[model samples]
Target: MEHVGVEQFPPDKTGDAMTTALLHLENHYWTESEYLAIGETPERIELFDGSLVVTPTPTVGHQYIVSRLVVSLYEVARSAGLHAFAGLGIRLGPGHIRIPDFLITTELNFDDRVNDSDVVKLICEVISPSNASTDTVQKMRHYADAGIPWYLLIDPRSETFHLFRLDGDRYTEHAKAAPGELLELTEPVVATIDPAELLPPR
Candidate 1:
């Protein structure tokens, strides 16, 4: 993937190249390969149903929760013979690629950059304010459509956790927890995390 000879655009600032690309790419119908060729942009870029979607850079609170989850879940997954990764692009289907905040798989195969759906056991996302709808709605639909067995959403603003188990073409709510509650996940991944521990220190 080439750099396209442009500085990565920050969430608050769009470089001329990015602006030009976004303008031209609108309704252009991009493929997952072309989207991956753009490399790492400051903003989160995803492909869904042949269109490109740019999401805002995650806030500190969002990253904080992701970090905490990694630390908390790694041991549990490892003890149970599973592997975990953060910010890994997953190829869901033709022209569909999603980068979960983190993912848990039965094994660690770092030989490939993008993982196929089969290896993914669980996909987790730390909801940012800028991406609430996309995370809660679009991503939920996409994950279920890809036949992912499990999906977890952690919303920092509300300090809540949501777990969804895939049932046929849709996901049924499996578990949920509010702040200060212990959220125990038994399938896909096994662990109990205190939702409050993921919150940033004031």
Candidate 2:
């Protein structure tokens, strides 16, 4: 996911973390507007089916993989006259908001508050340890429901990557690879990624 910079959370100041935890425990349902009004939160949060889902802060490993993938994908998208952004909030439908790890877009509006999935050619998510199911299963369904043409999932712990394409109302797996394998994709965007490079330093 995209971040301004690494935020150092000192142990003494745990208010934000505690509040986020409490909110999760309450299982509150939030509207898309409400979630958007909350700006610059201490926690990584998203709105799924009108429910607020809080995710743990990404680890260094996750950042490393996302950075490399973004760079690689950006090169391809830029050459194709498209823009690639990290951590942009996407509106999949009413009450459905997603912050994809990376998104390739054709729109140039910098002030766009919420980008509709129609212009999004590709969406990617680097699975975090705490929210594996959200990314792997829940988000996969959401993106499909939004009619996104392409979706990619990278798992740091498993050292695996998956690419999916929208088929009607569902997604069909197009390609998958483990570390040391090359995954080539075409259609919405064209690029090759070596899953091995996505692995964090040992």
Candidate 3:
């Protein structure tokens, strides 16, 4: 696969020519070849702010949490006449981003707006120990920068969850879900979930 030109990965920002010139990254010319060069698959991947980030399958506990959360979100959205999908490819841009967890997309008809399923109204991640820090600080900023409306983090270690809502081009802590508690997020979309329901039983 050829690399994408800066214009190809346009964010909400400008300076397309300058952005392309600044990056020595893969050119849109032969993206197929470059993708093969990566030489790894089956691992979860995401293009964050136009950079590739790989995440492997989670632990059994992580999977359990992700599964339950996905099911619940899907059920809720379906009832509301909205759409919720888990582990469906979402285009986060830079490379194909696959969040092994789940996402809630809004479009009645999915489009590759932000990278597959432009309608993604919400995103959720189960933070295993290996990704605690990055999930906390790194992802917090990245999703916000991407202009994602809602971001949820499921932290098993502490048996906690955090929800951030886009506030003025950035994410502000929308809710913190502790064990046995259900946190609510009702903006850019309206939904509520219980972190404990997604946590692995002790």
Tens digits of per-residue lDDT for model 1, 1-202: 1122222454545533232234332336566656765665676666677676666677888888888889988888888888877888788888777789988887656776577877888999988876688789988998888888999898877878998899999988888998767888887666887888877886
| Per-residue accuracy of model 3 over 28-90 as CA lDDT, tens digit each | 342422333443346554454444455657788978887787677766787666676666655
* Candidate 3 ranges with C-alpha deviation above 4 Å: 1-41, 47-52, 94-100, 108-117, 188-191
Best by TM-score: 1
Q: Root-mean-square deviation of each candidate, in angstroms?
A: 6.2, 6.9, 9.5
Cα-based TM-score, every candidate: 0.82, 0.81, 0.69
What is the model-wide C-alpha lDDT for candidate 3?
0.63
- In order, candidate lDDTs are 0.77, 0.76, 0.63
Clashes in each model (backbone N, CA, C under 3 Å)?
0, 0, 16
lDDT of 2 by residue, 112-172 (tens): 6677888888899998877788788888998998888989888777788998888999888
Q: Model 1 scores what on Cα lDDT?
A: 0.77
Question: Candidate 3, 45: how far from true, in Å?
Answer: 3.0
Model 2 alpha-carbon drift over 4 Å, by segment: 1-29
Clashing pairs in 1: none
Please rank every candidate by TM-score, starting with the best. 1, 2, 3
After best superposition, candidate 3 residue 160: deviation in angstroms?
Answer: 1.1
